[model samples]
Target: MTDVEPSTEITGNMQQLIAAKAEELFNLCDTEQKGFIIKKDMQRLRDELGVEPEQLEDVFDSLDIDHNGYLTLEEFTSGFGMFLGDQIDDGNANEQEMIEHNPNDKEEQQLFHDTLEALGAKDLYDDEETIMGLWMKLRENDPVLLRQFEQFIGKITQEIRRSKLDHRSIEAALHSKSSVHESEIKKLYDEMEQQIKAEKAKVLAQEKLKERELREQMDRELRLKEQQLSELTKKQSDLEMKLLRLNLNESETKSENERLQKGLKNLANI
Candidate 1:
């Protein structure tokens, strides 16, 4: 039933009729006066009230909005609004067709009052606003349309629930993948860091080895320089000694030549 706006006007007689039906259904369904009726007990209402089996599910679902499996007077009255205007079938082609219950009929009048007394909706009967409010809650005139609306709402609700579940599943999968990727990235970073440290250590060790080699080479060069200097000093001292011996030999030769010249001059005088 397509829910229409409650813009329809209720004449005084129409008000009385709706009130009577509301009270009747309430009493019939809530016979125990427990203030509510279970889904099973609603079969009486479905059978007697001329509600179709297919439509009943939607009606039950709509009336039992709380999903508590029971119908209060308020819920029952709202359901009554669905079937109030006309007979629940294709036989009555006129949407304007209304059941005219005579207020003057003694049996029907007493039944309406008895229903009110049993259910305590006397205030509802007296107040036009309250009765209209209940009537206005019905959006659709056709039972099939009303049931279709209910089914449509049910489908939409189901879809919403399914979407929420899907969203949660996607979030969980993304979270799992994110966690795995983060772990892999951290492992790779750690391996890279270790490799860098090892390379640095290797390079540092090589540099240190090169420095030691250079130091050893310098020490050897210094020792060779010292040895060459010692040998040159020893050679200079030996050259000085040889020059002194040559000077002494030259002086002795000059003295012997002078002595020989004096001997030759004495022999010429003899």
Candidate 2:
């Protein structure tokens, strides 16, 4: 006999709905939260619910809001409600439903990058501890339901990859723009440096020429002053010799007058 499908069971491949549920499930399963189960490993959820693995298949059907086959926080939380919430109150149905993510959501786009980074960082998907831990945490008891969740995860991962490709394209465009701007700035800077150096050289050459002219003027003035000094010394020597000759002539005249006076006295006495 074919296995009777439960009314509560839902299809796992709905991209719009079930994938979101898987992420939430993983968050709850994250080590920090003891109450959460990781769908990557559904045994944990099974253990938490204390239910057989087959029972989890109904989780997808019962929680699907849009029938898009993807589960949102509400659906997954509804799944978790069986195991984790000790509180009697239903937390926030309307708010949970509003959290539905379409492929175009920017935040979800960011989440795709983050998830890839996370997977790269931990290598958790490849390691056995985390995988087994995931199993123990969300799937051990409900093996069949775990398969459905896995189906949903595969669907989301494909979307995530596509999101990453689009993101890369945009990133490449931005990098190209940045490179162009940097090149322009460098060219401008180089031109300015060259102009400044040329101006400085011109100023230096002009200053040197002015100094040469000033030095030439100074030398010419010194030569003129030296020639004047030499002429003045020769004139002073000639004047000194003329004064000596005039003194000698005056002495001779005085001696002659004395002699004439003596002769006159002698005649008178005779």
For each candidate in the order shown, give its overall lDDT on alpha carbons.
0.58, 0.51
* Candidate RMSDs in order: 16.5, 16.1
lDDT of 2: 0.51
Residue 74 alpha-carbon offset, candidate 1, angstroms = 37
Instruction: Count clashing residue pairs per candidate.
Output: 6, 28
Candidate with best lDDT: 1
Give lDDT for model 1: 0.58
Number of clashing residue pairs, candidate 2: 28
**Highest TM-score: which candidate?**
1
**For model 2, what is the error of residue 61's alpha carbon versus the real structure, in angstroms, after optimal superposition?**
22
Off by over 4 Å in 2: 1-166, 255-270
Scored against the true structure, residue 249 in model 2 reaches a CA lDDT of 81
